[model samples]
Target: MADNLTKYREKRDLKKTAVPSGGASVKSSNGRRFAIQKHDSTRLHYDLRLELDGVFKSCAATKGPSLDPQDKRLAVEVEDQPLDYGDFEGTIPKELYGGGTVLLWDRGYWEPELNKSPEQALAKATSSSLLEGTGCTVFVLVRMRGNEDEKRTNCS
Candidate 1:
């Protein structure tokens, strides 16, 4: 059932791009894949993607991560967006579709501070926990900090 949905999504008329050169710092050691997509929904939102156990887990936010520990933001759990959503960038026709822009945000594996496995981290994440109060969904990227001696990469 999920496979069929994935196939249908892939066939949608949306632009899709693989990880650009230097986009990924390193492949996931755990074999999980992930992507970050900027969605042009009614209001712009960042769609964080994490693939685990053959399923795509997703969350969304209108803003990026907050530095202040007190600032509570809630992230909404959205449907599993298509992988092609990663590269989708353009204006949706205002008449037929609401106009908006989409860009790649980030892509990597799912790593959590508490959980050692991707599944564990995913299982631990819930709409209430992720949403918290600020409304920002937290997603675990596979790459570890300081894993590479390279500078941070940002998605335009």
Candidate 2:
């Protein structure tokens, strides 16, 4: 049993890429860049990631936009996220580490209501909006405020 556990840990560790210091660095399929961070909330939450293509999009697990039992409450929004946000998994190492397991919940492309491609969505930014009828209840749109030429840094 101990050997199995050790091997499992080793494999998990190997799967972890070197996150950037300001945040967790992720490379999308098209070679685009993004970052992710997990919020240490009582109910457990993870921030979905994508680069500042102009803004940071996010979502969380909570009662959401409504409290009705029939109403699903996962919310997604756009907000300003630190570039170093990605390395948050073990931040609270002692309190919530071992008991929690990380998994990929879902992934796909999203289209904004404004006819903006994912790349153009960042320009005409406002607060993130929740998409109804979509699996998650709330969604937000955000825009990046600075020059997009910043170099990516290592997360160590």
Candidate 3:
């Protein structure tokens, strides 16, 4: 892996937690990807993972992803995870670090609009302290049930 998943590996014991101790990166025909997971730990939370630097940059949203434009959910940044962790879905034993079940909510590639390149967009966000959740307006779209429609939502 281009990024050392030290924290990711250090957090859990493979013998106890179902979470993987990831190593080495895989190349997919698909481009940069992202995954949203429903994590039932100490409290229920939705995790957002963006593929970057060969690792999954993570964030946690307690209220989950919003489908309304006016909603600005609180998202706090978390440690990076292994890219393979995107596929993880199972129960971590009660004695484990994150002791609970995990569900994969969504997984897909991201399409950036602001900068000429995806890298540039990431760079811009980082340089402006946006990646650190400073002056950052994160917009996410989720297709709600009943009607297939898109809505803009922000996270900080």
Candidate 4:
């Protein structure tokens, strides 16, 4: 039930910003895709996006991903960005909503370790290790709420 970038478009001025307006630039791969963007906004943080139903479910990882396995990171769920956002690497004007340097840290397809669809898994938030490998790197994304504490793991 993706909103097709309705909320994403509302916050951005398509005519003034360089961010990709939701279009047909969706990933052509067979598996679901994911992206990690290192954003230097008012503050620096990592944004993680998982593609499902043609839109990316986005979140801000406060401390980025952890490798200690014992550490739990805080990820705040944000708006759904267009799937094409996976390839975006640029600087949004300071006057823009997410004004900052956005670097495409990583991008690849992922496999879900769930019994249901990704959209359903996200809504249920029941998967401990939501996603498997992003190319060769393996990471975990525990379902997160708007401002809730979520755990992410990187074992690459």
Candidate 5:
């Protein structure tokens, strides 16, 4: 199932770029971790990454994440990234792939609010909220910018 990383690997030339060349041997952590990267590439955007099953599943939020529950952010799912990417902060050559500066915006961990397996809880949340009927529902509780306290937000 982890074969999903093909797109990510294909887009990056590990030898040409300073980006870490992650291998399958990277040990998976038991506890979940998440990070948001401030990517200044073709456009400026905040990339949210949630650690699940070793690789970090990704999403791109154009205007950054919000602390208010009333503010719904549109987080479009992207490809799974290498776990070590959570710590990456550097500049890709203008001619290279990403071709811009990458900053580690925020880092933290999260727990499922409904006390079930993450997948189950998410599925339950989506079904109960009817977000699944529209599209995939992604729930994350994290420390966004300027927020000392963590807030849970649903990204559908």
Candidate 6:
């Protein structure tokens, strides 16, 4: 767990930031929760964080995830965040790393389709995921064909 948060801690000072600085383990029953945060940073984008292992596997969507089946959004993988980070909604100082206003846009549980483990699917992912949130249910078709850092997905 400490190994996973190494990069996260290095990016920001725990004393100044309002975000969680990871150490203790967060208990979870299924560990299938996910959150989409709308961040107003250097640019406007949505942050998608999926709970995996003991942390949140993060990514930022430039145009945000679309509900239209034909719309594809560009998403880039980011550093892992603590589980509690999903509930954060505040303003980060302008001088800070992720300096901006963050709003918890959507949050709930998610389950990978085909009965496969999330870790197994994400590492070599080219599958569908069922994201059931409080506001809506999104059927996400995630594809990671090569070694590219960016991912384009059409969520319906």
Please report, in order, the local distance difference test score of every candidate based on alpha carbons.
0.46, 0.38, 0.66, 0.74, 0.66, 0.79
* lDDT per residue as tens, model 1, 1-156: 255245334434334322222222333344455565676758877666666543456667677655466564444555554444444456554333324556655554434445345555544323111221123334323222232454532211
TM-score (C-alpha, index-matched) for candidate 2:
0.35
Query: Which is the better candidate, 1 or 4, if ranked by lDDT?
Result: 4
Each candidate structure's count of clashing pairs: 14, 22, 0, 0, 0, 0
Clashing pairs in 5: none
Q: Top model by lDDT, which number? A: 6
Runs of candidate 3 with Cα error greater than 4 angstroms are 24-27, 116-155
- The TM-scores, one per candidate, come to 0.51, 0.35, 0.73, 0.82, 0.72, 0.87
Q: Which candidate ranks first by TM-score, i.e. highest?
A: 6
Ranking by TM-score: 6, 4, 3, 5, 1, 2
The alpha-carbon RMSD values of the candidates against the true structure, listed in the order shown, are 12.1, 12.1, 10.2, 4.6, 9.8, 3.0
The candidate 3 region of ten consecutive residues with least summed lDDT is 127-136
Q: Is candidate 1 or candidate 5 better by lDDT?
A: 5
For model 3, residues 100-143, the per-residue Cα lDDT tens digits are: 89999777666544443555544333221122121223444331
lDDT of 5 by residue, 125-148 (tens): 342111111122334443223223
State, as a TM-score between 0 and 1, how close model 5 is to the true structure: 0.72
Worst 10 residues of 5 by lDDT: 127-136
Off by over 4 Å in 1: 1-31, 94-99, 113-116, 125-156
